[model samples]
Target: MKNTTIALLGATGKAGRYILKHLINRGYTVKALLRKPDGLDFRHPKLVIVPGDVRDAETVSDWTAGCTAVVSALGQTPGEPLVSALAARHVINAMQQHNIKRYIFLSGLTVDVQGDHKSEANQAKSNWMRQHYPDVVNDKQQAYQLLSQSTLEWTMIRLPWIEQTEQRRNLAINLHDCPGDVISTADLAAFIAQELSSATYVHKAPFVASI
Candidate 1:
């Protein structure tokens, strides 16, 4: 895995840090994009901090050069420009340029996709998000559209509520429904790292949670 370097988006995000750590600990080199690289808490030989924003297509391409894969844990930020849609475009372009095939994106259950048999509870979660944070909902939904239309081997892992806690394993995975309410950050990290190479859910969106 030392030869496999992954370009990471949203390294400052709650899930991003843990994901980065998990990759580095597993001996996977990572190029993590950060707006404030000086604020990073730790360092490792396998981790390279790339200072930039995902919205910048040029920066995204430059950051992705020579990387084997891409993983994003980007989430919407209040009072900031939309993130997910732009990240999708830029990342896809970068991936194409490098001919990279694997992309694993972190998203939520609020985005409705075709073939999804979301339960009433999940539908309600989407409705509430659209009613309140409509812009974010729109952006993230657009991100999904872009990802689905691409030919790349992509997995959009939808999560429920997230909590910072001890690392857990043996995640419950569902294709038609969200099987649980919450997942720990460590577990999410583990899943992403594993899914990067597993191709277990390629070209599909799966709901993952703690069992």
Candidate 2:
């Protein structure tokens, strides 16, 4: 882990901040790419906050130049397609240009198209989203498709509804299904940190959380 330099995109977000704290505490040098570096409160000796949008290919490539891996907690708000698509494309190109193979992205559970191993609750949730927020789901699915087809060694963590809870890090992982469990942001950060240290699910997306 000492030799690995991580370039974390969306470092100002809720989950990104947690990952930043974990990386800093573990003595890993992280280059955090955010929309505004000045707005962030966390300052660490090992943390380098780079001000930029994830949609900018040049900026993304510059930030990831010497990085061993990349972690993206990037997402879009409801009814926003441009930002999500642009950022996904930029990340893909940036990783390709820099030859940084490892990538871990946070995608929602609703993006899972395959129905294998899906619990009843998960199925219902998917149906609900399909009936209500179809556009948001479609946008996320497109982002996942881009990552899946890329040559980059990427793992898309399809997270369930996240809550800030006080629980142990005892989450179950599924390859193509939801875990039917809620997860805390802290626990998610711990899992991401663990994945960063070890290349367990490279090139494979998995559902994660404590059941």
Candidate 3:
């Protein structure tokens, strides 16, 4: 919108790809960090791809420098070592060093906030993730703690199961209960992009879904 450059982590992932595309299409400059730069096919004048590991603090710091804001669509893969917690620390450190404030992190409905009052369905979903992906759950929990305690203007967007559809539709958003059960990946990206410049959810976590 304002020729602003935002640093994006996990730009190669399913949701991250959509976020990247949406940001670029909206005329925002994106500096994306990819573990494998060669795997990305899209090229744009406003896109700057950085090849590095998110787990590497120095690498993340270097890539995040000089950006107006940072957004993460990171998620843990099955059996892979958890990087979310470590990456959060590095990203927060870098943002502080560079005086970049706005941070929007994409999370699942499984992660809970202090005053959250989830419905039975959402509770069941959280239990399932905790049982099946314990490490990821733990890592994400720690990341939440770091974010909640940070001075940075941060918003953690908690989403339900993500479907790989390009359709953008009405999304129910709530500060306590999860609004719905599922949402399209495209719509999720749209919400993140729309919130990039808004303070409605600053320093808060909100759950969103298709109603």
Residue 138, model 1, lDDT: 93
Which residue pairs in candidate 1 collide?
Answer: none
TM-score of each: 0.97, 0.90, 0.96
Ranking by lDDT: 3, 1, 2
- Provide the lowest-lDDT 10-residue window in model 3: 74-83
Tens digits of per-residue lDDT for model 3, 1-211? 7669999988888888888999999889999999899878889999999999988889988898879999999878777788888989999999999999999999988888989999987899899989988888989999999999999999999988788788978988999988887878888888988899799999999998876
lDDT of each: 0.89, 0.80, 0.90
Clashes of 1: 0
In order, how many clashes per candidate? 0, 2, 0
TM-score of 3: 0.96
Candidate 1 weakest ten by summed lDDT: 161-170
Residue-level lDDT tens digits of model 1 in 158-208: 999887765685688998889889978888998898888897899989999
Predicted candidate 2 versus true structure: per-residue lDDT over 1-211, tens digit per residue = 6767899987877677787888778778999987877768889879888888777788888988889889888766555445666677888898888888888889877777454567788878888987887777787788888888889888888888777654566788888687756777888888888887567888777888776
- Report residue 133 deviation for candidate 3 (angstroms): 1.8
Candidate 1: C-alpha lDDT = 0.89
TM-score of 2: 0.90
